[model samples]
Target: MKHTARPSLLLGIALLMCACSQQPDRPPKEAASPVVVAPAPQTPVDEVQRLLARAARSDPATANDLRLDAATELADRGDTVRARELLASIEGARLEGPQWVRHQVLLARIDIEDAAPATALARLDNPAMQTESAGITRATQVDLALVRADALQALNRPVESARERSLIQAWMSDEQQRRANARAILATLSQVDMGELGHEIGSATSDDWRGWLELASIWRDLRPGPNAQRAELQNWQQRNALIPSLEPAYRELAPEILERIKQPRRIALLLPLGGAAGAGAHAVLHGYLAEHYRQLQAGESAPPFAVIDTTSTEGGFPAAYNAAVSDGAELVIGPLLKEDLQAFAGNLELQVPTIALNFDNENPLALPKLYQFGLDAGDEVAQLAREADNRNLHRTLLLADASPRARRQVEDFNKQWRARNGVVLDTLYLGDLNDYRVQLERTLLVAQSRERSDMLARTLGFKFESEPRRRQDLDFAVLLADPVAARSVRPLLSFLYAGDLPLWATSESNAAVAGNRSDQDLEALRFIDMPWFSSAEATLRRSIQAAGYSGAIERLVALGVDASRLQSRVGLLTWLNEAGLGGATGELSLDTQGRIHRRGQWYVFADGTASPEKARPETPDPSSTEGGTAWQPQEQAPQTRDAPPRITP
Candidate 1:
């Protein structure tokens, strides 16, 4: 396996690196345990050798600089032992200035890597090192702060770790790197409980440290309404105007943040109310109005919005959009169809910011002011691939109903899975539930087991019974079918012998929670669906049901609610990439393609109801490696040719 081979490759390079340089005739100070070196490519080992050879022929100062470079390379490769050896050699030469700062920082880094966080902290706290490092290059200062932060984090001191990163943000030359550092500081602070965070803010010693903690507190407080949250953020920014390092990021993000909470002057909704899509459009309208009213009840200003039925209007999409703009509409949120979106995409006179209700994944277009938001089922296949990869389920079998949409999903999942270097052991398209046994038997090689028994019987004096075995090379199965079809297939899989095998599905297979006993047929099925069905939104679901909306249309209502909320914050998500806005539909984010993606929650069917899947442990058992087929027999092979209805294919 590549995973096991990787460490050996890095260790071989470390051995090669040791041979290239002269080792001081002294033992390495013993570590509590071996440093768990990160695997690296072979390129850096060659570079380290060249630097050391150059150092051998240089003057004392130049040689020490070369040695420092060599040590940095080794450290990056996770060759901590050899890296420390090189640093020790340089320290013996009495290095000074920027070189001395780099040497001390690197020694502390090695100490941390060797699990000696206390020693690392002591070395970095050397008052003499700090005074000398002050006049060093800005880059070196950032490096020293980063080393100290790592030491603090290793010691479980998150508050001090965040403080060290906060202190060096202004010294970073690259704007992008500085932004990343700020994000890291917030991330570290997020680990501290709110109680501890509040206590630290009250007792903070440095102004900059206190300012960062305050900003983090404002962001983490989710109880406040949108307006209240924005007001607090603006107030905090005004109070910390003198904090130079935090100002640039705030300035860059302010426009988007303000836009997020600000309501448009006039809004328009374009829906096909008279066409075949009228029912679906009305469901979406219900959801949109629900959120609009919810926001008003929370003391936010309500902007008047006009609904233009594209089906009843002249010139369809163009007429509806022009009418909205002519009436001074500041934002438009509609044209809920692929053809309508194409009309907007082709119209050269489009100027107002618009959010299309659907995306044309095949023919994506990115105009300056156009954004796409929708509940795209195709996106779920991509998510499924990622989930499968995360579970180490590489060798997979796909089973789906024979439909064009199912075919597209299979193709899509295959593309994503193969990109992750996963192998597709088999794919079976189901035409009828009655034939699943035949299809699965063929795919899982169950028929081969039967034939082997037949052949053995032919050679022997008498026939004996043996259980038919399913192929064990598949790690898991992907079920792409509707609830009705899944219910049938799931039980059939158990009958065929794979009841214990893991099965995965997407929202399509998720059925209404009507407490029907038949729902028990989906036991053990793990699937991803919107948070709308999660218990956290029990009240919201009750409200929707009170309005006489349920089943498939409920998802559209949730989509409509998200569309309403996203209209004002699309700009925010666009500028701050990867920053997701929590929406009723899911965690809403925008991809570079100008299409909004939703990441939903995972649930498992149990006791005739779906519940949130249990969170996976931070560290999984190494013996239970993911990927490849290794099925441990759950029961001994039966003496008869029959096995419980099988899960072979």
Candidate 2:
């Protein structure tokens, strides 16, 4: 279904690169003739920066274009305030379609990532973006499409995210068409003059392994069925092959690199063995301890685990530390809080690989050997984005509240989505929960139109696309805000649900309502979440309850336990990962940096209440538990006749 590439695409940049030097497509309209190219030894910046300095030399028009480009660069480097200053210098009214549209896209993306989706949406709300206006020209459509997609994913609509995928899919029908379409989209975007994006994709065949792998990952991640699967493997293989170049220090030096990775001999367990987190700590300990017994049962030596109370007085820490280390400990798990870490930091020597729940990135004085491995926000988003990609979701919009936390989430998600070549529609911000309906109406309707939908109507064939597809709006969104806000957004959900838009969520949506559940708008809405325990059968439940008993009665009765350990870990990790949209606890796999990659299972709400669509397996027979171990006979005790002997001898 992909339309063949137009003559305009062939005659564009690729052709220009083949012929080394080309005359100006048009003289600088500002009438400043002869732009200079610097000498050989000059830095790359020297040429680009020099012309930009005298941008205003000829006139305001040249100055505005140069200002836009400069502003975009600043924005790319995570400097919004400075970028905004440059943007203010440009007169928005003076710029034309593609240039003007590109400026709006960048400005809006910055606002969105900074948690001002409201402002970002305003910038991209140009009428030309919605329709093929006589004046807009085709060159700007793709940019508008990409930015609009970002807007949707931010809003928490995965099904609608799929629709955005459908939109991109229509641009290219088959596998080859999709890759070419992606290459085309990247090619066009490269010209938009966004600072980093320009360098994001150089010649794909060149030495730019990161760019190539990134693009290949996106393309293969999006395509579905057999062909897409094959493409995905090939692309991943290509990426793996180029890992050495992409991470020079990572792959090159042999033994030196190997030595840097400290393999723990014996890990010291520091956790709340006697407080609120005690049950959870113990439940985790059951797993860690079970790992030891299981290893020993398999004829492998069990690593000794030296457990300690993570919550300890300042005076107790040094003694406990010395004790654990003296016992051949090569690592430490907790001492969970910041106070304990700071108190012990100065006195501690680098004797073990410490796994703190807290990261020293925020605390520069953080302990030397400590590697933090708690729930990180970026790790969750990275995982969630991968899941979204696996589901073939092409377009993602991000909607976030205005806050530093929300903005950071936006930045991480943006980087991930861009890396995947997925489109971010509009990341809208919420000022007041009351304005939910009004705000969403503008977002959903303004971007979608009758004319384009009518033309693309027969084009997009998914069942969900019946009316919504014909409308140029996004079908899914990522609401990167909290649950309280989402609960308030029930009315907004009304707007979306009426349109049959499926709303997706991060872990936040599962939070208990502060007030009434009666008014909760999100209950019926479907989203993906991570459960700490993948197997939620009755047997799994009984096994976990038995593991956390504090009383004989609780231990004797499989039905009772002080707290629900399995649910707690799953629920907490679900929330934490949602803080990243990362997957489950048991599978909580991450890269060396502790970013979650392969974790969690995705659940959709098929019925009214939240339930797992897939059923979990029951516990195996005790005889068969250890990789089909032989059923052993139970030992019998000898009986005594004490009462008979006391009768009268």
Please report, in order, the local distance difference test score of every candidate based on alpha carbons: 0.70, 0.44
Tens-place lDDT per residue, model 2, 35-121, is 332222336764336546767574655665676666655655666676665554453336544455456566666666676544544
Residue pairs with backbone overlap in model 1: 392-627, 495-644, 495-645, 495-646, 496-645, 496-646, 496-647, 497-645, 497-646
Instruction: Determine the backbone clash count of candidate 2.
Output: 45
lDDT: worst 10-residue window of model 1: 1-10
Over the stretch 340-432, how does candidate 1's per-residue lDDT look in tens digits?
888855753667888888988878888777888888877788888887875667898898877888888999999999998999888888776
RMSD of each: 10.7, 21.8
Assess candidate 1 and give its lDDT: 0.70
lDDT assessment of candidate 2: 0.44
